[model samples]
Target: MPAQADPEPVTLLLVLEDTETLSSLSDIGEQEGLRVLHAESAQDALAILELEPVDMVLCDALTPGLDGHEVLELIQERWPDCIRLLMTDVSSGLEEALRAIDEGHVYGFIPKPWHEERLRLLLRRSREHLGTQREWMQREMALLEQNQDLIALNAALEQRIEATQQELKQTAEMLDKTYDELLHMHVTTARVIGDLLHHRLPRHLQTNEQVYALVTAFCETHALDHTLQQDLQLAAALYNIGKLTWDDHLLATPSEQLSANERTAYQHYPVSGENHLMAMPQLKRAAKFVRHHRERWNGNGFPDRLEGSDIPYGSRLLGLAVDFIELQRGMVLPREVPRPQALALLRKFAGRIYDPELCHDFVKLCVEKAPDLQTSGKAVISLETSQVKPGMILAQDIYSASGMLLLHEGKRLDQHLMDKLKNFEEIEGRNYTVLVYRP
Candidate 1:
């Protein structure tokens, strides 16, 4: 015989006045893996709630004395986390439902003749939410343990207690472990957000050789250090992280098209994006770029008013690149502008809108690199070994025209070996492919 699997615990409280309603709800609740507690009145419901941990509350609006609205209000006061659902029999009782929604803290309301599927959906979502809450609670409990350890350490030190050093060491170790766990969590979250943005953005970006060429030449021309170059790439890719907090509707609309409230909501993206990156100390420097990415060279930008040299160099580089991309893609509004026109516009606003020196270097790079920046308009199959030079990063997977994986990054193929690899038939047809930064 196989070992038995433990049953999932069900934790839901049902407060219904009508006997038939209770019977129907009970059957559905049990089938859906919930342990249902039944209550005929508000007082009984309150007692059961105090005795058992409940994840959700379902009340009947038509109940006599201490109606669903009043019961929901009381539950809101005591158990604010519980998902509240009220079943209404009469259409006129919508006011109570509104009150429950506005003040009584109801998550949702269902009609009296409720569909079983909708209830099941609500319960499933409620359970998932409860699980996330439980995870947070576990973290809080760990914090409490650390606090107790600190208290013990303090008491031992002040009272000249024995084993004070041992207590201090143990407390230090626990704190270190806690910090490591939190740090890992922060990194994992940032990576997830990064992956989401990469997947959702336009694919044409991969083929735009001008973008990469201009950026690289600009870095070289300005004599920018390697770290600043890396910062530029990271900031370019993540310039819009703040947009994640924004509603899809608002993000899709032009800034001028947004309503007053939507505009206010839109301003939060930069701060939210910064906070998201700042959580991991490893990426703290990267977070600073996101915060200052929008500042103009002049003293007129959002969130902060830092002008010219006061704005970070990394942020200034990203701001220029992102502005170019937005203009090229016509993200501004009305219509997308041509590359020459956009460049001309950038020139027009150089000193006031962008750092004059940086803008000049950027434009010069684009002009000088026009030949190398030209693409053959054919899909790049695999990167030639000759083109696999040092200091260049792989933008995407290297694949043959037949879709075979070639060389992965962090794998060195210095000039001579690259020459032989380039001679292969699969690699012969493709020109030097675009090199993209991975990290």
Candidate 2:
């Protein structure tokens, strides 16, 4: 490596009135590797301090215009980091030197005529103090930069976290809306299947209405959840969907009068109905309700043979509703049983074929609530396809000109169903006369 260059000398500023004293001090400072700058007055010295990089300042005690003490005080105010020293002769008052030191304007005073060895020693010590202060300032600047970088990074991280939270909220809302649409589609499909069955087997229209009404009343009385109540209502409307696969004679025959093979086949309708509903993922819960609707409280019913309490509550409610409707329709006996006789028969089977509590509630609902639902003298009006609207309950079954049942009495129309009826009429080259409840 090349020989190392000598370090740059520290700059010192000297303010003095006497040219001889300034020259002598400049010679001493230069020998000790100090670069000396001379100012004849305090004003000149202050001007030098503003324009130059200075490491140390020395002032003669008797400088003209401004005293050495006043010059040091000005340097302390304008350049607090610059090290200061005072030069005093034997005639200079000891009180002035003491005041300069006490007021912190000077580090210490040097006596004149100055000794060469002592002057050299003082200059070396002052340069070392200046080096230490510069190093400290450098370290402080570095720490400030690091703190600013950390603050910026923390703000960026907070912004990213807020953005992620907003995205999650939007995703949750979209999922909720998608779920609602899927539920609406599933319900519309079930109603279409129920309408097809009602057209083929006209009696089911009345039975579906009675069972749904009874189930609704029973669930309300028991304070069941709205989700379960809605499931049971859908299951009741679509209960006999499996009968579509049955032979016409088997469907027409009363349950008590069926042959052993016919009864066994009839029992499989619940399973078939569950299979049909399971095709739609959104209807899985209602499918489960339909699958166990025939299960007995004593576990003697077909398919799963699930016992009391083990049977789903919605299924138990459905069992009571279906049996009660079947009895009133005379599907369980040769002649149509009166509503009072149907209630008695349902009570007789409670705890064995039905949940005793639900059976009791069903009886109360039928006796107290059934009368209000009867449309004995209610006005029924016919409407062309263009005149019909959603939310209107059907007052009579709508059939095609060829006697094909298009919709059932008590089935509430919606936009989708109304569209289907219009499409069917257009396809068959006939206009349908839709009957709706007046109120």
Candidate 3:
């Protein structure tokens, strides 16, 4: 409980002016568990005080060369924390003795011939008082030490919180970077599937590139959110993936020219495409768009005839993009239609075949943005695979003989790309036209 106050022991100094008396009193103090020291004169007592600390003092009224009261009063001035007592005989004036108690601040007076019982009782009481003081001081010291420990803990806790905040910030940045990389990888994978379909149908026509282009343009001009943009673009590219599993005869035939058996197998391609995309976790959103892309505005469509608002909004957009391109490619009718006529067919069946409000927006987008539906506005020169060169820009989309856009319009050819074109024609065992801007 208390230490900045020096922990002096419970000790008593008896200044008797007689050696025999000092010896007897010292024994009594010892019995009371006190550390006792005795001196025969004021000089000896004052000297002991200089050498060591004392808690209680008992002195004779007639001290050698000095009054006991004077010595005790000196102790008061020098060490106020010490307790002072005086002893005297009948010859010493009682009035003087009582006055000493008041003037010197003495504890009590003792008779000239002290009683053992009285001395013992005083020593025991002094010992109890010292013990109580020690307990109180110890308690005060313990509280101070606990306060110091709290200060240290508070400092450590603040440091830990700061470090934790930094760690959380780093983790968030890492997650954002990872999400961007995964998005790039997903888009690239969808493009590869479109290339695969190109190879599978060696001589057949396809609208994969035109659908990809129109859908991407629409999303940008319309400012669709990122999730919707990604989903519709991937669906546009991969909606015909199910046709890969079909026989060449079925795939080459137009929709209106297919037999009843072929038509039944063809109608199920949309679901087959959905199943293929569901295996990839990143394409889960796109898979939903692919499955319902054929749903009609009324109640009659293929795969799942979800009508009205039951069809997801992104699926509706995918449908519009696919039909716009495929109609021109002659995949929807027995004969291919021009871009204007294809647009007319979409408008003619708008409320019954597509979401009318979204169709209105889409039809307008195609007319405004698709200025080169057949590459009309560009001066062109055609080259054989061997004549192509690096740095020449493609005036039109470069397609495989089977109608896969190997490179898009406006791409500047490089040696690596030229090598790729030659290598592809080499594998296919046929040559195709490469149209480029006249340089």
Candidate 4:
């Protein structure tokens, strides 16, 4: 048979006066995996206790010098962590037994002339107590490791949160600088367009206040923030700035038959806006947005051909507003479709010409706030020789008698027309609609 695993050993201190009893107990202890240190008297056991560490101390209550109670008291003081047990043959010493239990901190009592099974039982209980002590030590070590890990994890999380907060602060500053640049570029564009309008008109011309009013209404209706609303108004006010660099013939030319040069000149507005804005880094982001406003959402429109969501959000909003204001001024072909019809047409081209979401918001805003379209305020339109005081509409299209158009429409005018009026001058048999203005 395979050698049985050695039973767990226990250190025991035995105090006895008789040699026979010590020899008998030693044999039984060896069989049960107990390591015994024998003493002839209680005094000897106390000396042993001072010299070595023991798990349990087994002693007699009535030893000659320094009884079991005396020896236990010394053991309790020196090795307080050790378990103590008292053993005696005299029944008369039972009273002292109670005293040993109370004052000596003894763990148990064993009668003399000890039975083999009884000694085995006592040792087994002591072994179990030692096992419990070891298990407790293991648990304490595991808990200490877990606490250290938790502290490290908490420290790492705090560092990440601090870094994220710092990054957000920088991003906010960058966005602010970009907004200021957009406004400056827009003002420059307006001045150039205003000068051109004055040069072309017979009397005077100016951008309409109705444009600003409509843009403000659009922003409010769509719940756009203040900065975004201002950007939209500025963009619409300056969209036709490149027209100033073109010849008077083209500005007044009908849209249906534009010369090749006229078409090319008209297409340069976005570039003009970009060139003026890119001098400042803060303005560069806005320049990009402005340059791409004419691009189609379906990869088919001018300059950049940016498609769908690829176009900057700022440019998309501006494009929708500019188209609306131009249509109201009768600048576009077909005598500028009515507001309802214009919105309907824009909706059809959403996701192809303008951002689909912005288009939807623009249409909803116009229908809900239709009255803001009425024109107000006066802006000076300066020409080469003289500056117009305030009340002339440039590019007004008058019709011939034969259903042929005779004039063009401007993007903005000082006076707002209540509606388009029909004209029948110079052409035979047919009539056309005229873009009329009141001085």
lDDT of 1 by residue, 1-439 (tens): 9999684485788888778879988988889888888989888989899988888889888666698888888888899888788888646777768776786478778775688898788778778877787778889999999999999988878777556767888999999888666655554454456656545545542212333345555777678876666555444445577776555566556666678998777766767878877766666676888788778889787669889999988777767766776675656644655555566677898999899998887665543343223344322223344545555544333445554556553354466546655665444575434333422
Using lDDT as the yardstick, the better of models 1 and 4 is: 1
lDDT of 4 at 184: 60
lDDT of 4 at 314: 72
**Shift in Å, residue 264, candidate 2:** 2.4
Candidate 4 residues 117-196, lDDT tens each? 88778877866877686567668778877887888887888888888877887887777777566656565565454445
lDDT of each: 0.68, 0.79, 0.80, 0.64
In candidate 2 the C-alpha lDDT for residue 215 amounts to: 77
Clashes of 4: 6
Highest-lDDT candidate: 3
Residue pairs clashing, model 4: 395-408, 397-407, 401-427, 401-430, 402-427, 403-430
lDDT of 2 by residue, 288-396 (tens): 8999999999999878999999999888888888887788677888776654566778999888998898788777666545522456656555567799888999865
Model 2 TM-score (2 dp): 0.57
Q: Encode model 3's per-residue lDDT on 54-161: one tens digit a residue.
A: 989988888997888789889999987788878888465567778876775676777767788887777777667767766777887898888888888888888888
lDDT: worst 10-residue window of model 1: 372-381
Q: Could you give the C-alpha RMSD of every candidate to the true structure, in order shown?
A: 35.6, 12.1, 13.1, 13.9
Choose 1 or 3, whichever is better by lDDT: 3
TM agreement with the true structure for every prediction: 0.40, 0.57, 0.51, 0.42
In terms of TM-score, which candidate is strongest?
2
Model 4 CA deviation exceeding 4 Å by range: 1-83, 90-234, 244-259, 296-300, 304-316, 334-361, 371-439
Error of 2 at 184 (Å): 2.3
